[model samples]
Target: MNQPPLPEVLDLAGEHFHTDQYATYRDILEQRPVTRVRFYDGSLVWLVNRYEDVRAALSSPRLSNDPTQQTDIDLSAATGIPDDLSEYFRRNMFRSDEPDHGRLRKLVTREFTVRRINAMRPRIERITEDLLDKFAATGGGDLVGAFARPLPLTVMCELLGVPEEDRTDFQTWSQHVVESDPAFAERNAASYRSLFECVRSLVRRRRDEPGEDLLSALVEQRDAGDRLSEAELISTVFLLLVAGIETSVNVIGTGAFLLLTHPGQLARLRADDALMGSAVEEVLRYMAPIEMTSRHSLESVEIGGVSIDAQSTVLINLAAANRDPARFEDPQSFRVDRNDGSHLTFGHGIHYCLGAALARAEAEIAFGLLLKRFPGLELAVPTEELTWRHVFMRGPVALPVGWR
Candidate 1:
């Protein structure tokens, strides 16, 4: 097949891209479905914009999640993990392919099973109420800081048996680790070291004194057999802590922001409790927590009629795919009851998020309790003044909300 000429490389690290992503995505999806984009660090990746192409790229065997498979590109540098800590940070399932991905995922899959997640409902509710009680007492504050951020942090810490006293430090380190700004490179590296040492210490504690927590179970798995190595064990815990907490925080915060911004949708949800599930799904589709994910092409591949060279980085824009008009009707519109199809927010294929079920459960409980408690809930500040975090994970830094 004759390949189409590549489009001009666009800059994706600019403030415009961060401030108005959906608009930028819409333009790309329509005019340049398959193109290359340059990041702030001058690294280039082929950007897949349309829904079908993004979905196909995500599941294609030719695209490998493991960075080591790429020969031409230095993915290790792209990851921004300091050299000394790279082994500890990059050895998890999220960054692996094939047998290794399956093995690492299997070790913790049961803990996030539907049955296990469902079992967490009572405790999740209690945590939600406790957070809400504090918010209610103050009348209102930055919802993201006071409620959304802490809810998942608290849940994840409790699940992993992280000491209550250490949670503040953990949260601080996590924020630094996940920040994508080049200015924070030094801080990010320092945070990576801090996080690695912290998880390593937790692993030792779990090994010496096993508890009923998930981390302890993983520690036991390592001790009982050679199933998991020390690096793998600690890395898996780190992945769980960062991935499990940050994504949920984005979902809950973004979900509430969507609800407050779309009054009609909020009104419909308030009137019909059955719309809760669909509402959450809509939020995921409309404003995906993680906007884009990256993979490396192991072999030359064609997507949307554009041929990509082997070892080339390809970025799947989840937020753009979710809003592709080819897959969704009125894709830009936010509707609580609309059930077009499943969105790629939790993604598809082998690398689908393992904590998806848990995130959904937390969001449902959080929103249900929130609306019930504050029927008049609304944004406390002008929408234009709100600031979003410029990172892979998308959410407002602080959502000041009020209810009277």
Candidate 2:
């Protein structure tokens, strides 16, 4: 059987925010919606970059989110965690399929309803204001380090009742897991182990003394019935901690960068605080934090005019899809008032992000508070000098800003 020539491997995992890369995605969208592209580690997956195709593929039940079916890569072998940690990681809903996914997600999602998130606005504002108070002291600093990064990490930890003392450690471990370099793959194991231990200890504590917190609710549900397993409990907590922090952190950082660069739109947003809702959606569409996600075909299925064999890998480039010309009028430009919130940044179908409401609330509060406080905020360094980390969720490494 002769195979077709593979498409040029796009380095979507590495350096982001490049013109040439987006140009390639646009080219792919127009020509080849579904094609094979090599990941940074030389692994090839069926890359789906078109807007319509990406949405269809994401919602298709024939394609499963379970990576266990992808024989091409042993995910555990790559991460190299201990058996207990590995098992816990496997139980996480991010990789779950069907019945188990519904069961696990149901147990934890009550804490993440839009109303619940809306209720947290006062607390979220307090945190945002406190962060700004410190930022105001120096008048300028890396917004990522000072404001973007810490804001979500703190909010999530506080919500889960994580000790004020251990929030920093939690942030460090979570970042290492997602942003790990291929060179430091071995260190990745230790990071997971540390996080696992921390989460396990927290679970145990919640059992002993239940409180007005998400973890306590989870612990109570675990005790009540067969609805949640022990490992699932730990994994759910882990997922909430990581997902809640990672997505919102990137949104705040990336959203702020887009606004800072597109001052006209920023001014428009500032002038009318009523536009905050649309503004956040526009930011998400402009620069998705989690650029790509992969799924394994459950059976031989057709996607984007290509026949994918059973157990084949499918990688959907959400960032590229969000920017597809077919979807938006001027996909390249950043507009704060863009009304559509159809971006696949959080994903689609059953696997859509559980903490989306939380992410949205955080962004709305973070942006609203920051703009109100630092009306003079602007980049401290030239745009070219700004460094972006090639993490699973891409955002500025250090978004230095100055306020007049």
Candidate 3:
């Protein structure tokens, strides 16, 4: 039997979600849902492909997110992330387990509740319409830069009470934090330092002059009973800013790209407003922002007949899991009618995404108003020529579009 193309086979697949490779990966899944492979650093990792297995591994108590519990596996050394950059990810809810995760998540959960997100719909709709107006006036523009990137940045800025004037600076900081090029260590360091300093300033200001925003609330919590430490506050803000902007930006860009490319799905969503919610779900499934997540095994474990040793790195193939043929029929096809919410795009169980609701809200309004306002919207350039950001998250760098 032919084996699937390993990471060695396709070097750039790490940054770009090569859907074309899923066919080969699907075949691998049939043999064993979890397969061991060597990463670029020659470090071994278990790739979890099957949807059920991915979900199971994510929710399993055996899996440890706590860096303390797991053996030494420095993300900085492994990924070329500098000490300070890695400091941003050192410890928090995402890397913590159980009580810590629950406590940290609860502290900020109220700010992102479904109702709160829904309340922002009217404001989001206004933001969408205003952005569409700019695109409409220009006849055609780069949708990713003009619309997709700005909408989420705007929402996050408002939620965090960041002044509108500071958003441009904030965007610059975020781009560097997620930089994929391991070669540019000096450039990455400069940007990482700038971003850290910016966040620190914001935290200090919030501490001095508390406000209605999340940062202030968190600062108050920290001051009261030491609910959040300075490091935790910085990490939470960094996570919210990066995860908030990047995911929504790509979702809008990729979802819009898919809609424009798939006339049938576009028409289905355009004709019915009620289908907007499910349409967003399909878009998310089709274009998962965070394609993969890294996890390290706490102890030796048996998965798919293969023995994964303790301290082994693991890769959860989220993009592949969402498109697994075993779970969904015509997995490659873009179907707005599909109602399966089992997609691991936002992850599963305890590690489920905290910003899922806010993301859905932003996309629902952004896409809904986009189609309604510019019915003639079509790609300005040939799809093949469009540049894709070859990062952990994939999206068109610039989605230029034209309309009547």
Candidate 4:
């Protein structure tokens, strides 16, 4: 009912994750911590910038994660999913709330037990080695495209039973799905259809001819009990492919950037292999790729000392929260040995990232291999020249690197 008094309109468009942007968020946090801003799609959303407010909103049951409840955002255009399939996409655990979210998370969490994830170490390392073999051959290459993109993509595809044929050339579509650039706000509906249709076909095929893959296991779960639905089956596959690939890809890409830029930390990590876990956690904290997520107010709730009415759209700034001076000491600096991995990088609450462990494992292994293989690795292009994308699934578009 009121307008943003000139300064409240923040851009969530195709803007690079520039340093000044963080300062802007810091300013917002210090002043109106819980305020409104317009997203790139011309959709107005309540932006929560302060650490406590963001953390509370992320886990608060009073705020709903269901995209269908959102009146401000045009879900159809933003997500690039058709009407029939949009419901399935929206019902995915990431977007679902309550018992449904719990059930979906429970089923997937069972599949990611320590034993199962540990078993994949060999395969993950093997994939990283194979990718490194190629990267080293190029004397260096675009790390994002060459190594970061394919390694996790291969691992996720193989683990989820997504055929190799369906994995290539799909990143651009997923990137658009996560971001809304004013210049390219027009989403490619065809590409989105092909993506979902491909996954849907794979789901059906897995049912008819099950395999020893995670998707088949999920299919078995669906068949054994009414716990999983057809829509959910598609949605799970959708999440594993999109979030699994995208999340891990950006973490690996940017994690490498961190090591490259902060050589002292890089040297410290290289000196000790045990720091791999801590280093990964530090990277997640320092620069959470999924900078922000939304929650629709289920009831009138007080956040950041301000009472927000029910049904109001709220944006939780994960990146800002991760770097909050109150939560983290010298939050701006990158520390490889920052053992206190309590940052809300993977998020908090029931909606905490399902694939967080897997993402961490991949990054640790990927970074370790890079340290061992490319001792003197440095950015092929200057840092300022790097391209960043997506207000949501964000990361360097192309990470060119060279090494001795």
Candidate of highest TM-score: 1
Report the lDDT tens digits of candidate 4 across residue range 190-247: 5567677787788789989999988998888888897888888878877878888888
**What root-mean-square deviation over C-alphas does model 2 reach?**
3.4
Residues 63-111 of candidate 2: C-alpha lDDT, one tens digit per residue = 8887666777556554555655676877878888988899888887787
| Local distance difference test values of all predictions, in order | 0.87, 0.82, 0.77, 0.80
Rank candidates, TM-score, best first.
Answer: 1, 2, 4, 3
Q: What residue runs in model 4 are displaced by over 4 Å at the alpha carbon?
A: 1-6, 14-19, 169-172, 182-185
- How far is each candidate from the true structure, as Cα RMSD in Å? 3.0, 3.4, 2.5, 3.3
* Clashing pairs in model 3, backbone N/Cα/C closer than 3 A: none
Backbone collision count in every prediction?
0, 0, 0, 0
Estimate, for each residue in 1-404, the C-alpha lDDT of model 3 and write its tens digit.
Answer: 67644443333335323444455556656665777655554445678778877887788777787655644444454444568566565556787887878988998899899999988889989888888888778878899989999999988988887777678988976776575555554566676677677888888888888899988888888889898777887878877888889989889999999999999988888887788888889888876887777677878876656677887777777877888888878888888878777788999998899999999999888888888888888998998888776535767889989985
Candidate 1 on 1-404: residue-level lDDT in tens? 33334347777777547778787788788789988888656777788979888888889989999877765545434445788777788789998998999999999999899999999999999999999999899988999999998999999999999988889999999987787666677788788888988998888888888899999999988889878888888889999999999999999999999999999999999999999998989989998999888899988999999989988888899999999999999999999999644899988899999999999999999999999999999999999999887647799888999986
Flag the better candidate by TM-score, 3 or 4: 4
Shift in Å, residue 371, candidate 1: 0.4
Comparison by lDDT, 1 against 3, better one: 1
lDDT of 3 at 161: 75
